[model samples]
Target: MWGSAGIVKPGLERINRLLSFLGHPQRNYLSIQITGTNGKGSTAVLLHNLLNAGGFRPGLFTSPHLVSPEERIRVSGRVYPGQLEKEVRDLGKRFLRRHPSFRKDPPTFFELVTGLALKHFSEEGVEVAVLETGLGGRLDAVTASEPRIVVLTTVSLDHQEFLGANLEEILLEKVAPDRGGCLVAGEVPQYLIRLILMRKRKVGGDLFTTGRDLFVWRNGKGSFDFSVRGEIIEGVSPVKGTGFQAGNALLALAAFSCVAGSVSGKRGERLLKVLEETVIPGRFEVVPGHTTVVLDVGHNLEAVKAFCREAGKLECRGRRVLVFSLMKNRDPLSLLRTWGEVADDIIYVELGEMFHPFRRIREVSSLLGVKVLVAKSLRDALSRGKKIAGSGGCVMVVGSHYLVGEYYRLEGKTADI
Candidate 1:
């Protein structure tokens, strides 16, 4: 049947086709939909982990899987048992055959994966499924799920072509319909604020934010400390390398407050336990070394700016070198300009063989007035970047999560020194 072989297409017909084959499983349960320019995956992970810990039996879904396609779905902290993959594949085949017209346009990889997650969730009778949008939120396959709670993490100036150049236009297209409908901690563009005010007059729903509901902060200790809905916990948040994770924790807490009243406390405790156990592979993930290595999956200008500012606050004094790579769709020059200030040198490398590399990493570096070196492979780039940092200088591996994931896989294979 029509699976992930064709060039990517939009519209819900193929998704509907796939779901029908799976017996319309997504409609079986409520879902928490997460959409944003960045941090959507991390936020979804946090919510899924905590909700599962609490006893909600949530099915978690996120995009651009670091390890495998199955990583996209988590049931009580992992993709369901191996036997289910065969079932999903078989079902997808049945789906494409059923819809001859829709089958002409195959479901993209993400759409198929999303379909499988929903199908699995429905089969397991999950309490809720945390669904993260793949890219632009409007027509994304997950939006068809009709989320009960829509969490819009910070909106920023990325995906300009697809999302629009300004916040007002983008928010209208990406995040307004669900206005007052459990809006989480977003960057809150001025126009969005205006649109929200307009929405409130009609009494559609109640919009929420960090200041309006909960608060996040950092204690002197290495762990994150934060206050949520008047409850304070030190080190309750444990996302690595991100100073703003406490903010995300607050966002999750607010989301729970808005909708999780039905969940039992014992189940809530379990969710907290799972959250403590949850680990997103690349967002601000740190690697141990004499000169510490930090990896962040911040590809956009705003996210990179945030990552750099937070990394600077760590006061990493050693020769700080950066391993930079990005996709063709991203703003490479803007990202370079933002990251250039934080590093003594940058080694540019491709995240994968499919990426159309920029021969201009050096030129962007020159434009930004930062030292740059282009390397042929991630191993070579990382090794050279480490050497450049010397004994005390810190090395930052960043730009794309793909680069970080490749390095992580390599790190697992090397014998400990």
Candidate 2:
């Protein structure tokens, strides 16, 4: 939501009302609610994959689909059938029609989608649902379910306009899920970590941190090991990016371990199998071709830094080229400076004018004091980036999810992996 212009009414009353009218489908299944500025989607997907591999019928609810709205909801890594989705939408409309109050004060788009996902999960008889918060944790529609386990991935300074301007305020708003039971967090700053501990203590929740309670370290190529409460899991991570992904994997494993009890050697082996097979789209995904193409949805500064760090690790034969854009509110110059440190050339492309009000290419180029190639469209940008990279080099598409989504739309790619 930070990358787009949307009125974020941060309150749970609307979603609560909608869920109550829909028969509280969320209560019918166990759930894990994940929240953070970044890494929540990847963490949620990883947890979903773990549950599915562990013989549990898991439903996943994520956000900002790369191609279609249906990508937001899935059962066992598969989108719900079109007929099922249509039925749920019709049911939601019928409920709204019957309840004039909802019609008068309409639920937000996210609220409606949350309800639909919960309903579908319930109807599909899922054993557990992994819900990634659409925005800040406290008032996010997903919070209405009161999940059994809560996972907080790295809390950075994004969505400040809606959450807060500073780290303390943002951390406070995002720690709403630290109510009770097990609360797992990534290796965030010490100050934020203290805030999380304080909040968890206030709510009588047990906290498991990446470096403190859970330990994870890279073992070898594409492999990492994690230890929690005297139990250790050595596995190969499918996510190919900065070390941040290993932390994300540990967070997911710790959360699932807490929910499913200790991770035995056999279970750890199963988790590793799932981790090696799972691939999340738009998170440093490598598309095979003559020139390596990496795609990621990293709009914020922290995310951009991670993307660049990971891209630098790739074995590029030629120059590294970048195709990028960001929303109007973000500091495009800072992003450019970070990317410039790793990229040999940059091609700035304008995204959609409505939701994605991307920064002007000329403005960003001037601020950075660097000559950047301006493309008339995403297609042109890709062509130019590939041409610059040549057959031996690599081209990375980064900055906003909108940019990555546009690329997928142009390429007619609907698969998430």
- Give the 10-residue window scoring lowest on summed lDDT in candidate 2: 1-10
For 1-417, candidate 1 gives per-residue lDDT tens digits of 434422345567767667777778888987888887777887887787667655578888876655445666777776656554465566556666776565556677667777878978988888888888876676678877777688888776666666688876666556633634566655475666677567556746666665555566666675665555565555554553455565666667667766665222454445444455555677776667677888788887878887887878765656889887877766677888888788888888865544546565666666777767888788998789878888867889897767776776787722110
> Model 2 off-target regions past 4 Å?
1-7, 83-92, 220-222, 240-244, 355-359
Assess candidate 1 and give its TM-score to the true structure: 0.87
Each candidate structure's count of clashing pairs: 11, 0
Angstrom error at residue 8, model 2: 2.6
TM-score against truth, every candidate: 0.87, 0.93
Task: Quote the positional error of residue 191 for candidate 1 in Å.
Answer: 3.9
How would you encode candidate 2's per-residue C-alpha lDDT over 188-235 as one tens digit per residue?
899888887777777886788877888888887666777876688765
